[model samples]
Target: MAERERSVEAMLRQYRELIEAFVQEKISADDFETDYIRTFTNDKCQVPGSEFTVLEKLFFDVDDYVSDPELRDSPEDLSGEQLRERAAATYSKLFGLE
Candidate 1:
């Protein structure tokens, strides 16, 4: 149980770093999305020693975050900075980091 918790925490930390880089323009949204999907959704995706069920739930939550309409439709009207801010806020909230 403790090991599973640690794995989840470590995964979330990696995600936070990726998100912060995206917010800072160190990585593009497209690139972030690609990496995020590959990390959590690929067929062979695995977090060693993590409970499969727990990881699955976390991945689903992230998927919902990615598909959020506010973020999805923002490109229609929002400026680059605005989009980044929105993404940062959403990610922080989703990850319980806010």
Candidate 2:
């Protein structure tokens, strides 16, 4: 359990650094945008006909992926409101808004 926690923490840290670097223009937006869009669209989580910009898709992708564990652990643990709250918070962090 401790190892899993540490691994998760490390992954989160790496994700944060990658996002920060991305926001700072250290990486090519084209490459990032392609992968970001692919993840969200291929995941089948987005509503059909939902229009999203590159950044918006990135935010949603991160939030959706990060929240997977919580969702899987206990699907009934989170209400719709709670899930939205979690997604908002996660998106904020990914965007350096919090």
Give the best candidate by lDDT: 1
Cα deviation in Å at residue 32, candidate 2?
1.8
lDDT comparing candidate 1 with the true structure: 0.57
Residue-by-residue lDDT tens digits, candidate 2, 7-96: 544434434544454445565444444454455445433322222343354455444443334454643444333434444454465444
Error of 1 at 15 (Å): 0.9
User: Which run of 10 residues does model 1 get worst, by summed lDDT?
Assistant: 60-69
Winner by TM-score: 1
Clashing pairs in 1: none
lDDT of 1 by residue, 17-82 (tens): 766777778977556556666766653534664344544543443444443445665334444455
How far out, in Å, is residue 47 in model 1?
Answer: 9.2
Candidate 1: regions farther than 4 A off: 43-83, 94-98
In angstroms, the error of model 1 at 21 is: 0.5
Residue-level error in angstroms, candidate 1, position 6:
1.0
